[model samples]
Target: MDPLLILMLLAMGAFGGFAAGLLGIGGGMILVPFITMVLTARGVPETLVVHMAIATSLATIMFTSLSSVRAHHRHGAVLWRVVQLLAPGIVAGSMIGPWIGKQMDASTLAWFFGAFVAFSATQMLVNKKPAAARDLPGTGGMFAAGGLIGTLAGLVGAGGGFVSVPFMTWCGVRIHHAVATSAALGFPIALAGTVANVFYGWGEPGLPDYSLGFVYMPALLIIVAASVATAPLGARTAHKMPVRRLQKVFAVILYALAAYMFWRAA
Candidate 1:
């Protein structure tokens, strides 16, 4: 990789790590678009750019989630019981998501990603509070919800925070707890998704050098190094920051990225 590209990846990792910790996201929302840009600029085939971006994004979350969740755990914000209940279904859904993604063409996947990002941004911009009387569902319902969140996260290369955070808040989980637990959940989602993506994308043609299935190894390694270093900082800030104001700003960014994805599809 060029020296400039390495610097760019490091910067991307720092921003993504901070965002992951601050938002209880896995940082995929930030990483995926930028990774797509990097891969596309490197002359990767359009057919493989999104796949590599999403897969590599998920792979990084496997590391970032650990860093972010450790900070959240220190703050006592993680709900371990909820993580236990949701994890099994999350793994199952994640295992199959890449197979589904493989069936879609690059444009279709880009469109799907664009729409998903737009929806998530809308939710963040609105910041709707769930009804006070609502509460988390039974174990079975939690599993089902986890399945949905994991599947979408796998498909979109996100940390499942966009869906999980909103769902948890709706179920009366405190916002901070929701974010923290969602961070904990990111590990399983990324692990399962990465495994599945590898299985599905292996032996496919048009992949660039240093590729591991759909993942680009160099980006993964460099990004993880920088992201882990910044994630704890972001997590600590989350305890003190005005997250509502931050979310609005982040939502606008997401909207812009969504527009970019649409343009990429076109």
Candidate 2:
């Protein structure tokens, strides 16, 4: 890789890691589009660029999630019981999601991602609260929700926070606790998604050199090194900051990214 490209990857990792920790996201939302652009600029085939970007983004999240989750765990905010309940379905859904994505045209996937990002941004901007408070659901409900979250996360290379956080808050969990638990959920989502991507893309033509299945190894390594170091810092900041305001700012950013994705798809 060029030295400049390496620098760009490092910068992206720093930003993504901070965002992941601060928002309880897996950072894939931030990473995917940027990585796609980089790969395209590097002459990677357009057919494979988006898939590689999504897979590499998920792979990087594996490290970022661990770093962020550790910080949340230290603060006693992670709901371990919830994680245990949701993880099985999350794993299953994530494993299946990449296969579904692989069947879609790249342009179609880009459009879907743009729409999903826009919807998530709108939800954050609205910040709607549930009309009535309710407790967490039973095992079956939780499993179903987890399946939905994992599937979407895998399809778009997100950390599932855009769905999970709101869902938990609606169930009467505190926002901070919801965020912390969402961070914990990211690990399974990313792990399963990455593994599935590898199998699904193996032996596919048009993939660039230094790729493991769909994942671009150089970018993943560079991003993970920086993201892991900075994620804890973001987690610490999240505890101290006013999260609602931050979420609004993040939503605005998402909206801009969504527009960019739409333009790229066009």
Candidate 3:
């Protein structure tokens, strides 16, 4: 709620949003950690700040995803078939992640998050195997991928793109299309994750003010506004650069954040 913090968040949003759009990352990976700093600085109960940040970032992704997906769609990169195939699974898995997140301590969540982020980064650097492209399985495979992405999403409060993008790319979807379709998945991931987070934190004792469910609205609004404005810029830039380098760079940043989260969690 402090004026200075609001400005800082918006500024961070603009920068992170641009990178997210260009990279097909949901930005929550970065935003949640940044927000954890803010919430903790404001004298919030330390135990709850990380949870609130993750939950709130997931909520914001629902809105940011629409804009990023549109940009990717215009590039003719989004494969609707893929999004349709994976969505149902995402919804089912997301419904339960937040509840489980609530049951654990923030430190445990941070460790889980850090490890996951590091793993995703390594996958990016190594260019992991691709998935079946449009050759979606009848029922079992779809359910499996969706379940995995969704459950992790709920547990981590992510947009699920970290897993979804590579999986699709390996499956035979082109990189651009994989990223675009993964962007589309953010909406459902965020929505379902948001609902569960709210319920998870609803009436338990000891929470910060200006929270809706587990989200801090002030940070949410600033992040959404700035991310929306800059995502298109990132989308346009994504094509202009050597994506291999970009992936590595992003991976380093992820590692850096992962380290920071680990330290903080400790």
Identify the candidate with maximal TM-score. 1
Alpha-carbon runs more than 4 Å astray in model 2: none
Q: What is the TM-score of each candidate against the true structure?
A: 0.97, 0.97, 0.93
Q: Could you tell me the TM-score of candidate 1?
A: 0.97
User: In model 1, which runs have C-alpha deviations exceeding 4 angstroms?
Assistant: none
Q: Quick one: ranking by lDDT, best first? A: 1, 2, 3
lDDT of 1 by residue, 1-266 (tens): 88888998999999999999999889898889999999988999999999899999999999999999999999999999999999988998888777788999999999999999999899889988666567888889988998999899999999999888889988889989999999999999999999998889899898999998999999999999999999999999999878888889999999999999999999
Instruction: Compute the lDDT for candidate 3.
Output: 0.82
Q: How many collisions per candidate?
A: 0, 0, 7
lDDT tens digits by residue: candidate 3, 114-170: 888888788878866665556556667987798789988878777888888777766
Please state the error at residue 164 of candidate 1 in Å.
0.7
Best by lDDT: 1
Can you give the lDDT of residue 99 in candidate 1?
78
Clashing pairs in 3: 130-170, 130-171, 131-170, 131-171, 132-171, 133-171, 133-172
| Model 2: lDDT to the true structure | 0.90
Error of 1 at 88 (Å): 0.5
Residue pairs in clash, model 1: none
TM-score of 3: 0.93
Alpha carbon lDDT of each predicted model: 0.92, 0.90, 0.82
lDDT of 3 at 48: 92
